[model samples]
Target: MKNIYSILFIALGLFSCQQEEITAEDHLISYDIEEVPVTEDYTVGALYVVNNWSSNIEEVPLAGHYLNGDEEAMKQHILWADSAAIDYFIFRYSYPTVNADNDILSAFLNQNTDSLLNFALRYNFAQMNLTKENTLEGQGKKEDFIQSFKDMIPYFDQPTYQKVDGKYVVNIIAANQFYCDSLELVYHELREEMSALGYDLYLTGEQTGWTPPARFEHYYFNALDAVTFTNMFNNAWYDRHVFLPQSLDQHWQYSKDYYMDKEGIELIPTVAPSINPKISNPNASTYIIERDTNFFWSILNVAKKNIGPSRTIIVNSFNDWNFNTQLEPADSYGSSSLQLLRNQTKKN
Candidate 1:
């Protein structure tokens, strides 16, 4: 998905896990997967709270505890994976304060002990784009967005936990943001630069079939290695307004099948039970609904069936509350959602 900043070419594209151990007290909890324990190659985890989670600063909830809580989350996640024996998680940089080099992300990646979950970060060079429009803390603009991203590359250059083919495997996100035409121009440039730095790039997007099949094919389909479509069904009303209880996977099978046979693009299948925007300020024009656990697992099953070998299955999100497609353990379903994922991965 590409984001049209109105300031640029004006289109937009938009856009983890853990493990561990055996415990009796953990058994008394609601997360069904929490009770059982498994040891397999599967890794299932969630998006951790960002450093901005400290509230009113930038993002919401400010899950600062995740700075340390991730270890616990991993412990709990591993316990739940018992059903599916999940061993890997697509984790990302939610807390940049811990270690910008991804050292914070890698610690959990080691999985030195049993009943543990492994990880990789869905890193974003765009965070540097989070800076002020022209300065460090002013406002944002499309013209400045490019430089913002280029500046953030140093952080990801460091060695982290999980490496693919040797180097750290990072799901470089929002490569298609700003505008598909213009932003991607920046992407190729960044890709070249990052490659020179010896970093591997895994591009994810939703252009595979967002429009008439022709347009999708012409612009987005064959352009990248993986496509993690937005877990959203908004803007369906032809722009102006959006309605929630959004259909994330609506018509999703068509995409899964298309990417599988037609484009042969690696499908990073993302499944979210639902989409919502209630968590944001009242003015937020986005969604605000959580998903149903069963639906999420259904997508997981779909991913397992479609992807193989160089598998890079990307769940809709580990923590995307504002637009509401988070897989992290929350009050509503507790650990039921994660349990379903853990169980399904074991089958895969």
Candidate 2:
């Protein structure tokens, strides 16, 4: 009996050692199993493209390829974004109000009555061929521009629409199109128009390149409340053609030092998980930025550190599958990528 007792004690000791080994491995896991704590230090938004409205998608979303005007998909996405601690989804909208993107946004707005997560609009000014040309025609177009803002007032009025500094937020893509001498005047006119209607607007312009164009002079800073880029891939500040971690670090500092530090304009830092447009554009460039979670963490670290006063960081996209930069879940990474964002955005 005494011998049996001794053997049992030895077995228990071995089991205890095995449990300790398992606990160490669990600690090595990168993300927190607990719920991500909500953050207020900075706000995170994502560019959500509505390309999945059509069929024949080669890439698979964890939520499946949803149909056009699918409110269910939007709900699923809103839940995911909320879980990831994303503050809003900036929809890529075009004019005419008859496209798939508009349909998606309409459906999303219909179901977003609860204001669970906020939404914003991003217009592609280049595609619209809209510019501030400083001519009689340009002056007429400024009225047209004001009308566009008037049209969007309904969207901006939504309780779920994102607001910063008590003004409705709107992002302008291809902002470099405003290369005319009257760029500042054009924006001033728009602001006055909106103000007359009792609607305040906060315009965030997306321009390519790092340094301010000589033509823009001080007018560029005067035109928009904040400046941002779609992504760093197209920005002309990088030394190497290939995108790398070191290049991004330098780019962020250069942008901050020149754009925000020198000029009083705020900078909404943009970051992307990956970049490979070949899937959509068959003739797309071979240039690609491979996906690396550690690298992504480094990016969030750098972006937060250099982010301007607005304290906003916009992810390149939530579901731009064509460019292969979607943050939405997939079999490849599941929720790990978003969890990284949630984990990093926490100030505490």
> How many residue-pair clashes does candidate 2 contain?
0
TM-score of 2: 0.79
Best by TM-score: 2
Per-residue lDDT of 268-315 in model 1, one digit per residue for the tens? 555554555444455555533336564455446545544434554555
List candidate 1 segments past 4 Å from native.
Answer: 1-46, 49-86, 91-115, 127-168, 178-201, 206-223, 233-250, 256-263, 283-294, 301-312, 319-324
| TM-score for all models, in order of appearance | 0.54, 0.79
Q: Please, what are the lDDT tens digits per residue for candidate 2 over residues 267-290?
A: 777888876756655565456666
Error of 1 at 32 (Å): 25
Q: Model 2: which residue pairs collide? A: none
lDDT of 1: 0.47
